[model samples]
Target: MPSAGIPGWSVIIPAYNEARRLPAYLDEVVAYFEGLDRSYEVLVVDDGSSDGTATHVLEAQAGHPAVTLHRLAVNHGKGFAVRAGMLAARGELRLMADADGATPIGELKRLEAAILAGADIAVGSRALRDPSVTRQVRLHRKLSGEVFNFLVRRLGLPDVADTQCGFKLFRAEVATVLFGELETIGFGFDVELLLLAQRRGYRVTEVAVNWADQPGSKVTVFRDGPHMVRQILAARRRLARRPSASS
Candidate 1:
């Protein structure tokens, strides 16, 4: 059994209609944390999934006390779901991972190591080329991602290579502060969060990790791309108006 008191880690997964794709990943996450002695909690936020997503998490909770479910009344975007989970998380280290499990749960070690090394935020990147990291991405998705990232750099966050990676680790305090102030409630929230971190003078590091393109992606390059770009621009304007700590 995990030790009593505060949990060492909180894994927040934002799921929307992920009944078919989430179960295996949820089990994998639970199995991974079960082997370790440290305390951890998995908060699977169901963004009003029309399927049995909430029911599945409830059933898992019966066997694994650490697995909890937070259900939204209506389908909010991934960002809103993740923000809810982050704010509700009680662990010292908070991690937001995709329900599709694009990045393996084992990769948590790399981000965890970054946090332990004094970084405030550690983001998993598929853009960074590392011999140890294996990435199996679809050609079309790869090209679209490259184009989108180029825009992201040109607009803001030139320092960040891959802002859309769903795997990110943050210290509890940082998670609270960033998510609490978060305005973007869509897929573009990652860019805004990183921008806020930069303005807050927090340390952010990108680590290459193994990733594979998963089927049944909710995002469409043609449909959601423009929306994401608009959200990023709006976030930039809003943040620009607000004075940073240094100011």
Candidate 2:
């Protein structure tokens, strides 16, 4: 259980059956934040994973007081899980990260700096300046990602280079507002989140970070690709209809 005060940072991981890969990341998060001497909490939203993902987080909580678990009764998409964690977080700064740790946890310093420098949201970008570290995906996956970015730009958000990157940081107020209004409950949720943030006049910036393509990704070009496109289009329409908040 968290104390009454807000933590300095809240790390929210939307996990769905990531039992094998999640523990290492948890260890890293615990070690890194503890060493930094900042008050922090780690929330693992288990999206109804049957593979004992909740159990692992529970065990982690036993070892670390900063760790917590939220279990959904049924498997929801990544977007829903992330939304759950983001809305429930009690940190001054909230970060939503992939359970696979595609972007190393240490890269958070870059994002924290951006937010402190006046950006309301700082998102990880694989397309920005190169990093000493690189992640390799299949050639076809790489091509498909390019195509998806093209569609994302055409659909609405032209300024964002990579909308699907799984690492993003937000101020607590920003996270609560955007996520509270989220409509997409799937992979396209990131795109929608950024678009809404822009519409609300929030400063959003992309920061290049070390990223690697982890195995066991949930996205597939053939099956999920088309669904994601539909979600994007729907998000655009939904946002267009939404009354903008006063700047």
Candidate 3:
């Protein structure tokens, strides 16, 4: 169990119609965290899936008390689900991982180490190569990622190499502050979060971790891509006008 005010770690997964894929990842996360010397909690925020995603999460709860489920009445975007879970999490360290388990659960250690070393946020970066990632992504996906990262660098956060990695860890206080103030409710939330972190003068680090592109992903490059680009540009302008802490 966690000490008085904090769990050792909180794992938050924002799942949208992930019934077929979420179950196994849940088991893997539970098993991995349970063996650690400290206490942790796993919260799955179901983004109003018509499929049995919520039901599956509830079933997993019966066996694992640390596992919790939060259901949205309608399909809010991934941003909404992740923000809700991040605010609700009670861990000293909060991590957001994709339901697809593209990055292995075992890779949490790398992010955790980065935070322990003083980064307020630690993001998993596929751009940085590591032996852990066994499968390389398809050409189109790789191209899109490079394009997106380039935009993220030019228009928004120049320091972060990969904004959409789906794997990030934040100190509880930092996560709460950033997510509480978030305005984006779509795939671009990752960019917005980092933008907020940079605005707040928080240190963010990128670490390489194992990742495998999974099938049945919800993102459509042609559809969501342009929207995400707009979001980053809009957020940058919005943040620039806001008064900073130093102001």
lDDT by residue for model 1 over 1-247, one digit each (tens)?
A: 4426889999999999999999999999999999998899999999999989998899888889999999999997988999999999999999999999999999999999999899999999999989999998999989999999999999878998999999999999899899999999999999999999988889999999899999999899999999999999999999989877540
Q: Please, what is the whole-model Cα lDDT of each candidate in the order they appear?
A: 0.93, 0.89, 0.89
> Which candidate number has the best lDDT?
1
Residue 75 local lDDT, model 3 = 97
- Residues 1-247 of candidate 2 have per-residue lDDT tens digits of 3334779899999999999989999988888887886789999999999998889999999988789999999987999999999999999999999999888899999899999899999998887766455766678877898999888888877888888888999999999999998989998899889888988999998988888888888788899999888888898888788787754
Instruction: Please write out the lDDT profile of model 3 over residues 1-247, one tens digit for every residue.
Output: 4234567889999999999999999999999977888888999999989999999999999888889999899998999999999999999899999999999999999999999999999999989867756656878999999999998898868888889999999999899899988988999999998888888899999999888999898888899999999887888788888888430
As a TM-score, model 1 comes out at 0.98
TM-scores of the candidates are 0.98, 0.96, 0.95
Off by over 4 Å in 3: 1-5, 131-135
Off by over 4 Å in 2: 1-4, 131-133
lDDT at residue 56 of model 1 (Cα atoms) = 85
Local error of candidate 2 at residue 64 (angstroms): 0.4
